[model samples]
Target chain A: MKGVTVLQSGGSNQMELADLSVPESGQDDLLIKVHSAAVNRTDIMTREGKAGYAVNPILGVEVAGTVVEAAGSGSFSAGDRVMGLVNGGGYAEYAVMPANRAMKIPDSISSAEAAAIPEVFLTAYQTLFWIGKLQKQEAVLIHAGASGVGTAAIQLAKQLSDAKVIVTAGSRRKLDFCRELGADILINYKEQSFDEEVLKATDGRGTDLILDFIGADYWDKNLASIKHEGRWVLIGVLGGSELSKVNLMPIMSKYIQLTGTLLTPRSDSYKAELSKDFAEVVTPYLEQGKIRPVVDSTFPVEKVHEAHQHMEDNQNIGKIILNIASAEA
Target chain B: MKGVTVLQSGGSNQMELADLSVPESGQDDLLIKVHSAAVNRTDIMTREGKAGYAVNPILGVEVAGTVVEAAGSGSFSAGDRVMGLVNGGGYAEYAVMPANRAMKIPDSISSAEAAAIPEVFLTAYQTLFWIGKLQKQEAVLIHAGASGVGTAAIQLAKQLSDAKVIVTAGSRRKLDFCRELGADILINYKEQSFDEEVLKATDGRGTDLILDFIGADYWDKNLASIKHEGRWVLIGVLGGSELSKVNLMPIMSKYIQLTGTLLTPRSDSYKAELSKDFAEVVTPYLEQGKIRPVVDSTFPVEKVHEAHQHMEDNQNIGKIILNIASAEA
Candidate 1:
């Protein structure tokens, strides 16, 4: 089998297509014939040798493919169309996915679209509902509104909880995309003070929850944008991580609950549970076309570096895909 | 009626007993002939005119006494022994408590003991179960172990959840008191590296929950002492409020849920609900003498300034009470 491998002599964007053996399916695993894989910041981090938890030498973390071999007594069977998070090795001809974490791709969704759903949607679901506990009609402020997780969170917050979705993006195009996906308020963070805009939009009460992707740069603004007893879920630190002279007195005074999380580092059992819950609640929305995956563009497996670069440049509005195999074949 | 009032001529410990009209009970309130009032840091803040939420000029937050007038259609009746959080006039001969927030004084407890229970116990309850969401048999690290809320938390964690209670205090005597109150591990924070002791005690996984009272000073140590997915509830900022050059990456990497809260500033309805839930779960234990209030000592109402000074000097363990009227009478 051919897979994407990081070069030992490392620098930025050091990856090569190399031949490797097909992974053996474990007791509760399925061997998948990879159709398409999604590119994420985690993959970029893995390529840069920065992600400590990326134990699997392979580059990809999520895929949409066909199950070639299923585990004994597993729900999935051979030839079933599926999409789920892979332990790694997703940018290849074949990959192994845990049976419990696998979700059957709907007939209406294409392989490329299916590949985009698992990581971002599940992360958004976890942050908005599982961690943030966003209540019905509550307001949520999602930063990087056109990014994969940001886009998914905006839709999920609106669809599942009937929440008022407020989003911040750097450009008018990205903000428009977010607005099209049910965002009630859009702030071009480059031009305006997002915290002031959020306060004005919410009549000074502030949003009930904030999905913070920019950590240090937006800490004070995020704090200012959240309501009393609000929830703040930190999913990324795109701008930076270190904060200087932080006055945490506001957190106490506001009674804010702040949580930081990453989905890739979670245990297999936790992923399985999250996947199951995500599938149960969100699959119907996909099938009904009430919610859809936003695929910005797809790159052939050989152009993996470009796909990563595109994400790093913040040029994409949604998921960037690496086409591993032609589904028509 | 006589109440402790902060002097307008500003200075530390500037409080005087002054004649004041008896407060009239609201629609859902109980007018109580106060027997005892518990002294807290809030009282000291009030005396210094530092408490922004101290709407009433009187300087106390919790009281225990007999109800002299109950709401027209309330649960309590005249002559009923009650203890609860007061809006502001707790350190007075006559104070009014919200009927819904009032708890019946257990027959086994004295007025001073009952006065000690409401604020600390309720604050501990809010931090531990409400905000922290501590699970059964989980390990908890309580800072200021011999302080009012710390002692209450140690007892509650042991009695209610059968949790492994680890505590940190400044003195061996305080640690010993914590041990007597069911704390499993005690660290004299003055002489020992508390984070190292906590890690050693928990075999490096760290505690599941932390009741943090010393904020900025303990920030890093508390971060190091909590387990992945741990809950850190900030209920006080005694050490300091500003954190210099703080790194927030660990909060996300460890998936820590951090919340900050103050019981005094919470809305009336919230307090009523918290009081209701707390009384339902903890009243029986109080009645059985299984969980008793830890009142350090009582000062006559006329010596209210001394009580504030005692707390400021950190000379007392558990609660310091202001005796307003003799309970026997």
Candidate 2:
């Protein structure tokens, strides 16, 4: 099998394409001949040696392909199309995951699109509904609006609820792109502060829920930008980690809730519950033409390094994917 | 016309039951002839002037009374036996308030007991269900177990859901009292660390919800003691307010939620909603004999200064009530 491996940590100079033996699948696992995979911030972090004892300690978590071999006890037969999530080990020609984690790809959606769904869509769905409890006619603010999670969140917010979805991007081009794709209010952070803009747009009441990625630096502003009894969920902390002394007087005054979550490391049962929740909440919207994953760019599997570089630079307007070799019959 | 007034901040030395004129009721107002009142930790804080501006900025919020006057536009009328929350005027013969802040007190419950419910019960109810989203069979940890809020929370947890209730108090005697009240586990913080005891009780899973008062000092411990996806609600800062730095990584690693709430500053619509929620969810439990407010002691209205001092000395198990002059009708 051909795959990308993280040789060591440090910069974008680490990932290498190499030949490796395909491993056998367990009785409950599906051996997938991966057709495509997606690049994410986690991949960049993993490339920089941040897996932190993840079982596989490889890289990549999103994949779409045909099952070349199903462990005899599995439900899917050979040649069945599927896409699945993993803690890592998806940046390969063939990967094995628990059958339960692999879902049959819809006939209406291509494998490339299917590849994009596992990580971004699940993340957006889990954050908005499972965690933030976003509702109709309420409001939400998504930071990094051009990123995969941001784009998926906006579409999910629009499709699942009649929420007033607002987005923040670093550039007007990205802001305009998100606005056309259903964001109700778009703030270009480079031109104006998102905190000020969100306050202005929400009539100084702040948003009902906020999907935050920029951590500690935004902690104070997040407290300021959320409404009375608002929920602020941080799924990523690209900005920084430690926060300066917080008075907490604001939390009591505004009655704000601050929570942080990561979906990948959660136990299987919890993930299953969240997966069911996501399927029930998002699949119908995807099936009907109510919402769709936005594709920003694609790279051939041989050029997977370029895909990683693009995602590392955070230059995409939506999900950046890698097209692997065609599925084996 | 007479009311309690504060001469200045700092202990009961500043709290005085001085005379003042009663004001007229607005369209949404009620004028109650106070029959009894109570002291809360916040009252102690207000005595020390820590509750800087949440109250009317004129008087503190506390109440127990008869509806001497009502505007007929809100929820009550003249002559109704009432006990409700107010920001600052309950230690008086007359108190004016928005009608919705008052709840009907059943004849089965005394004025003193009724006076004790508003601040603590409401706080616990709002924090546990509305914010924490605590569910049946989920484990909950209540700090200061014999304190008014702790006692009420223990009863509410036992009555409302089958969740395992755990508590921590300053003394073994206090822990014993909470244990007899159905707390599954009790930790005497004076002798043993609560987080370790909590871990022992929960089989190393930690608490699903934690109600904390001592801030900064207990910040790290609360984060460690809470389970994955658990909620930590901070209602007070008795130990201290300033933390040198906020270790946010722990929150993300544990997927914990941090929230702060102030009951006094809530709007009429919000409080009314909360009041209605209490009436619907909690009042029935009270009526069914499943839960009841715990009144530790009472003092005559003229001895409010004494009541304040008693609370200052931490002399109550549950709530301390201030009774007005007896009437022959």
Candidate 3:
């Protein structure tokens, strides 16, 4: 099997394609013939030897594939279209996925689209509903609105909870894209003070929940934009991670619940449970086309570097997928 | 009726007793003949005109007394002993308490003891179980170990969930009191590095939940003391509120859930609900004398200023109570 490996040399790491043995599936796992895999910031971090939790030398964390060997249980069968989080061999021709974490790809969705769903959508779902506890009709401010997780959160907040979705993006194009995907209020972060815009949009009360991708840079503004007793879920720290002389009095006065999370480092059981819940609630939406994974672009497995570069350059609106099936064939 | 009033003259405020009209009970409220009232940091803040939520000129928040006039709902009769959180006017001879917030005084508990319970116990309960979601046998770190809320939390964490309660206090006396209240580990904040002590006590993983009272001074220590995915409930900022050059990466990497809350600023409905839950879960323990409010000292209503001075000097452990029955008589 062909897999992407991180090669370290001269104090820097590079991603390279290498011939590797097929990973063995555990009793409760399925050996998958990976059709597609999505590029994520974590993958970039893993490739750069920064992700401590990435034990598998193989790149990628999510994939859409066919189950070549099913688990002992009758939950799935060989040749079944599956898409879910992998234990980090997703950028390979073959990978092993836990049976419990596997989500059957809906007939209406393509493998490439399914590959985009698991990591971002589940991350968004966990951050928005599981951690944030977003209530019906509540307002949610999603930063980096056009990013994969952000886009998923916007859609999920609108679709599942009927929440008023407010978004902040760096460009007009991203903000427009967010608006088309059910963002009620859009703030061009580069051009506008988002906190002021959010305050204006919500009659000065501020949003009930915030999906903060930009951490330190937007910490104060995010604090100001959140309502009293609001929930702030920090899923990313793209802007920065260190805060200088941050006054936490406002957080106390407003009674904010701030949770910091990452999807990749979660325990296997936790992921399984989250995947199960996400599939139960969101699979119907996907099948009905009420919710869809936003695939920005696709690259062949040979062009995996370009896919990662696209994400690093922030040129993609949503997921950048790697087509692994052709390379495997 | 007589009540304590905040007299704002120049830059400072003074607490003085004055003749006032008896507070009337609403349809769902009980007019209580105040027997005792507990002094809290919020009450001190109110006296100094620092609390924005304190609308009534009178001081105090939690009280214990006989119901002079009961609510129409038949939940309590006239002459029934009750203790509860009042919106304001707790320092008055007669004060109105919403029926839902009222907790029946057990035969085993005195009015002074009951008075000590509402504010601190409820705050601890809210922070530990409600917001913190402390599970069975989980370890908890309670700062200001001999403080009212700290003592209450120590007992509740031990009694309710059998949690391993770690405490940090400034003095040996305070730490002793904490140990008596069922705290498993005691670290004298003045003598030892609390974070290092906490880490040692927990085998380097740190506590699952933290009840932080000292904010900025303990920020780094609290961050270091918390376990991965730990719940840090900030209920007070006694030390300071502003943090300088704080690294939030650890918070994200550890998946920390940080919540800032103040019971005084919460809504009437929220208080009622919290009171109801507290009464349901805790009333039996109180009745059985399994859980008790630690009352430090009681002062006559006329000596309200002295009580405030005592709290300001931090000379007392547990709760400071004001004996209002003598003045009323």
DockQ of each: 0.87, 0.66, 0.82
* Backbone clashes in model 1, listed as residue pairs: none
Which candidate model has the greater DockQ, 1 or 2?
1
Over the full model, what C-alpha lDDT does candidate 1 score relative to the true structure?
A: 0.91
Give the 10-residue window scoring lowest on summed lDDT in candidate 1 chain A.
A8-17
Docking class of 3: high
Which ranking of candidates, highest TM-score first? 1, 3, 2
True contacts kept of 2: 0.77
Judging by TM-score against the true structure, name the best candidate: 1
Best of the two (2, 3) by TM-score:
3
Model 2 per-residue lDDT tens digits across residues B1-329 = 55666787876667666656676667788888888778776666776777665454334366777888787745677888887777577677777767776788877887888888888898888878887788998999998889888898898887788779999888877888897778998888888888898899899999999988777778877877899888899887767777778867778778888888877667767777887788778887777667888888988766777887887787579988887644212
lDDT by residue (B15-51, candidate 1, tens digit) is 8888888888888889999999999888777777677
True C-alpha contacts between chains kept, each model in order: 0.88, 0.77, 0.87
lDDT (tens digit, per residue) of candidate 3 on B18-45: 9999987789999999999998888877
lDDT of each: 0.91, 0.80, 0.91
Model 3 Cα lDDT, one tens digit per residue, A1-329: 89988788212137788999999998999999999999988888877777878888898899999999996947999999999998899999999999999999999999999999999999999999899998999999999999999899999999999999999888989989998899999999888999999999899999999999888999989988999989999888898888887887888899999999999999999999999999999999999999999999999989887787788889789999999988856
Better of 1 and 2 by lDDT: 1
CAPRI tier of model 1: high
